[model samples]
Target: MWGRTARRRCPRGLRRGREALLVLLALLALAGLGSVLRARHGAGARAADPGPPRTPRLGRREPVLPRPPVPANALGARGEAVRLQLQGEELRLQEESVRLHQINIYLSDRISLHRRLPERWNPLCKEKKYDYDNLPRTSVIIAFYNEAWSTLLRTVYSVLETSPDILLEEVILVDDYSDREHLKERLANELSGLPKVRLIRANKREGLVRARLLGASAARGDVLTFLDCHCECHEGWLEPLLQRIHEEESAVVCPVIDVIDWNTFEYLGNSGEPQIGGFDWRLVFTWHTVPERERIRMRSPVDVIRSPTMAGGLFAVSKKYFEYLGSYDTGMEVWGGENLEFSFRIWQCGGVLETHPCSHVGHVFPKQAPYSRNKALANSVRAAEVWMDEFKELYYHRNPHARLEPFGDVTERKQLRAKLQCKDFKWFLETVYPELHVPEDRPGFFGMLQNQGLKDYCFDYNPPDENQIVGHQVILYVCHGMGHNQFFEYTSQKEIRYNTHQPEGCIAVEAGMDILIMHLCEETAPENQKFILQEDGSLFHEQSKKCVQAARKESSDSFVPLLRDCTNSDHQKWFFKERML
Candidate 1:
């Protein structure tokens, strides 16, 4: 050992080299052992503590929630959750929104499937079937004529908001030759992004009535819902209308209208509960409601109350029924009296007209009258005259102060009415809707006709054939004809007599007559000559016409022959009901 040690120390360079090599080998061995230990430790940890079970990846497949069965009573509380679920998806957060929407649709058809989903997910899903599928699909038809952009956008958004996505098949926008600079292009461009929106532009101006007819022709849905260009929709509007249609197949339904301030574009609350009132000969719309007592007596909201007529704007009906009713009277010149014509025909032709409380829409009432089209106004007046001929006597009876223009021919409506086998207006009042408070004389009540009896005869006398006979009976009053303006009072109990030549002479008729007529005499007629009938049926005259002749005729003919002569007179032959006074 001493000799070996001496040899190793003999070379210092050799000893240093050997020591370095040994150190290198030891470090390599230690590194290898450390790596092996780390591998073993990682495997042991993974095996000893199992991680939570991994959920199956859904991948590209859409998640579906089962559809719920349609409830028998859709309006009940049981269905409320489902409806909220469907509507709520519209506001979901971006990441989860697509999945939730798909789930909502699937659940709408299968509620049971939704019930099976995890309890945590129940609040996010809607599983009720709103049974609109049994009802006809509705096509919302809107006419745009230089409509304001904001108004149009609001209308579109409102419809989308209130209307159920499944029930709405299409929205038809008819452009009646609007001249607004950017309206056509902007409308088209914006609507391009929406599905089931159709834009139709007419090169020439087709009046409102005709334009609507054209839109209806193009519509594909089973039901037609007509909306004005300027309107905002309220919640639950579509459901009520759809329900009504389902209950009464032949019924025409209108939503309650709330007025909007045109200047501010703000909603002015509803005028009142919607009531249906007829027009006087002047074509003024009257507001009346179901008596409070009568409304309170009803047990359910489904009561079929009588409405004298419907407001032309925001009305709905089955497309088939609309077409069968002659579709807005092609003969009607334009927009004016078309609504009245539609109302009368629907009521008189075995169809029911109603206003639903659950539905509401807003319209802009003009602060000032539009003055651009004198011809259009005249045309509207002409249309009302042509279509509301039978009700003319009743109209004038209620509106004595109205100055009516002569009516032209209406052969088209007559032909259509005959083809549909429409029942007479009298039959409609007496049978199908006995609850309606229609007076015996519509014109007389409205102060339009000169005599209640004049509606029966075709006119045959005099120059200006249209004006030969006074339409309404003259009423004599104790005061100067100026006591009340000459037109008949709508709700007064006393008989009126013409005491002065003032244009304010009131028209008088029998208390129970179905129709009333008024004679609008020249403004300069003598006051003393005005005549009135007393409670005893005796004539009291200031002597405008021969009092002796009037008295003799009052007793012998009961004023029937004079009325017949006027009715037959060529002047009164062509009358229609104008909606605008």
Candidate 2:
């Protein structure tokens, strides 16, 4: 040991060398650690901030979350500990957010319903002005069953804030026997303070059709506007819709519906021209890009465009005209086919259906429906029986299981149809919906490819892109009724086709193939081209004798169909519900 005076000190050079060596070792260790970190994180270089999420679209993937905040002085050991603590807090907040999202069903419902939406104006709307003073006062009737508090209240406020006081007569809220605590006396208490708002509760749970009828009967306004409980009215959403109805009482007009993101709650406006409502042969609702013919036919893009169907969520109609046309098929249960029934009835019963592009309203479309849909199936059968006529075979081809489903009495509806002397479905199809595909030749062998084991998963052929280009990998996807990709037509000749392009190609399979592919339907049938429709709903191959099945690999988020032995397994039992009729 050296004294403070350093009488017996070591060599200065040796001391300096030891100090330098220690510093060098520390530098080397830091460099090595930095290189390891770079190698690991270089592939996924993250941005400091990723801004807000994009608006959700129909059949599109969920948007990415915004970047979380980070501390600025996160350096050194103590700072590192503080950073970890902050990260943990963020994690807790994320968990709480997820819990709230799960309960609300839509992410936006977790936020304040009174929260402001971004202003998006349609160019056509800006250029035009409606006779707002002359437009009839509208009785906005909204119906709900167990709707979230924010979602329901937001719809009410959106209407109140957007609509002119003089133009809006009242907002009728029909609660279909909601069991939620928030919707009980608390809801009544809230509504009691709001002017021109009435809350009606059904003693028993009635379907939307009847619930709407109840609201309509109670309505005193000249025009009746029906909106879903989860909707946001834009600045001028009401004026144009009411103007169109005022122009023609027989016109059942709908506004341009903008989508409110189900996951992120971002409001997406009409970016392109606009989309009009259409239906497939199955009578399932669909959206199509405006045809050039329609553009030429209309006086202007802002002008009301004739539509063959309504989405059932939002529409404005003259109260007298609504009553004259038979308000709704009162027999329709819980909710499913009333929109199509109303659409068909409107067309066949001498009423015109149109969509007003100048008016825009945002609607929340959930990924999964909130309520039970078995009643919707029953309601669909009722519509087919009453209105579809001989064309109903096409519907049955798409939904074979619906034909035998117990749908309550439609005798009154049938009498109404006959009493009105409604045009035959043929004339309506030829005249009103000529663009719709007619599957008269389609036999009843094809439908949704539902797996017996995985009841939720279906054998879907819809390609990744909405466009069904040739050689697109056909995979299993969630079925939304005989939709574009969901359509399956199993021919009498034992060939399965999709989306009504029969004879173009049948669902082809080959021996020793792990996955199924859509090959061209040849005039001269190959061994792989042939298939056998078993009574058990399995598609058995003529060559391989294996049944068609969707893979049961751990996750159902995505998967493909596979070849397996025909057994009593539910996996093998599949329903080709949609046909190439």
Candidate 3:
């Protein structure tokens, strides 16, 4: 009986063990099914409404952060023109606007500092890819001298907003002895809340060139970018510049500078066609359409254009290369010819100067600069004396007074050129800048044109301002042989060009009207501007079949020039100052 009871107890224990095993297996199966259902539900949820993406494990994958999207609804977004009707007090403020910033500060203050710009680049640029991870970081230097509050901050915000945080080290604001009250503690306080920004105040009034050097000295990045205080940087503006500098350490790159309307504060995008920098005999920076040679060299529309010079207000260069090139000429005072000086140095000293179409920056082009321009002439003279070599004579011919201007000592600069063994200005002209028209290219009379009939009176032309060179009346005035307004260049092209600057004026005659006016010189040498200076010293108009004759205006005692029938009269006889010698 004990044996049978033991056997039954054993069976009962075994049965209980089997039941516990079955329960455990069933629980495992149920849990597995629940997990499958949860996974399927999760997948369905993701398909229906995916939440913010989960970043891959940090070390496992390096992710590219997308650029911050510009606010579409913000004011002045998409670079649309902002027009505001002004009356009463608002209209009165416009004068003050011009006096301060040379821009419509009223409108600038109203627009959002973080406003969006339209994608002005070619569609090809959108497809272009760059290795952002490997690109050099830049420290943007902005030098302001009593810059307006809104425009200055807007410039700062535009850079901070548009530039990749990883690529931008900092923005160094160099105050060039600003006396404005707002630019002191108030400006400091405003920038204090911003990250990656530094303010350096000069003890005395340092000019733009020195101020930029100050900022560059404080920079701690692979590249140094210089921007005007009143500028708006666009998307992708900094990348191509830094990329070019990364690829070619000797390359100094600039963006396609867009125009920001001064009167309206409207952001005007530049034409897709790039304009490279060139200078006239004046040694002043001027823009010209990219030559066919440069365009042919480009494999794509977005390729970098080899520019002879820069607009000087905006550019990026490797810090090491900049220092190696001796940086800016600290001897330069105020603002003027540094662009041409640096541009010449770069090419002559075995460096490349480029303008990248993929990069764009909007600049506020003022009606007139709100500062004294007395130093600009001196600055230009300095550049000519340093880098121009024998070519300096061309500049002196156009601007005779510049020879008398007291440009500071350039012995150190000359020594630097000798130290670097830089190529001569002739090489610069023949190789880097062949498009520049050297005045001596054609053999013709050039100087202050004096008329024999009018005695001491010369062909004096004074435009309303420098920019209004075209479509101005040429008048007769007392000949002052200082070689300014009376200067004229009778080119081999048979066009009497006003020798003031590039985009020089040509004396033109209307089809029916007898007026002799100064018009913008055309490349085609239009028949109307063609004139033949005869052996007898008469300016015969080729197109009108007439001669430029001096006549007294019935309205006043002043003599005015007009096209008249060709005659052997003394009134038709003219002589260039060089011919008289």
The number of the candidate with the highest TM-score is 3
Candidates ranked, most accurate by TM-score first:
3, 2, 1
Number of colliding residue pairs in each model? 79, 14, 0
Per-prediction TM-score to the true structure, in the order listed = 0.54, 0.67, 0.82
Over 4 Å off in model 1, which ranges?
1-129, 270-273, 292-299, 302-305, 369-391, 394-409, 428-494, 497-581
TM-score of 3: 0.82
Candidate 2: TM-score? 0.67
- Across residues 311-342, which tens digit of lDDT does each residue of candidate 2 receive? 98799998977886778887778887789999
After superposition on all C-alphas, the RMSD of every candidate to the true structure, in Å, is 29.7, 28.0, 18.8
Show where candidate 2 strays beyond 4 Å: 1-110, 440-496, 500-516, 519-581
Best model per lDDT: 3
lDDT of 1 by residue, 10-34 (tens): 2234456779999998997687765
- Screening candidate 3 with a backbone cut-off below 3 angstroms (N, C-alpha, C), the clashing residue pairs are none
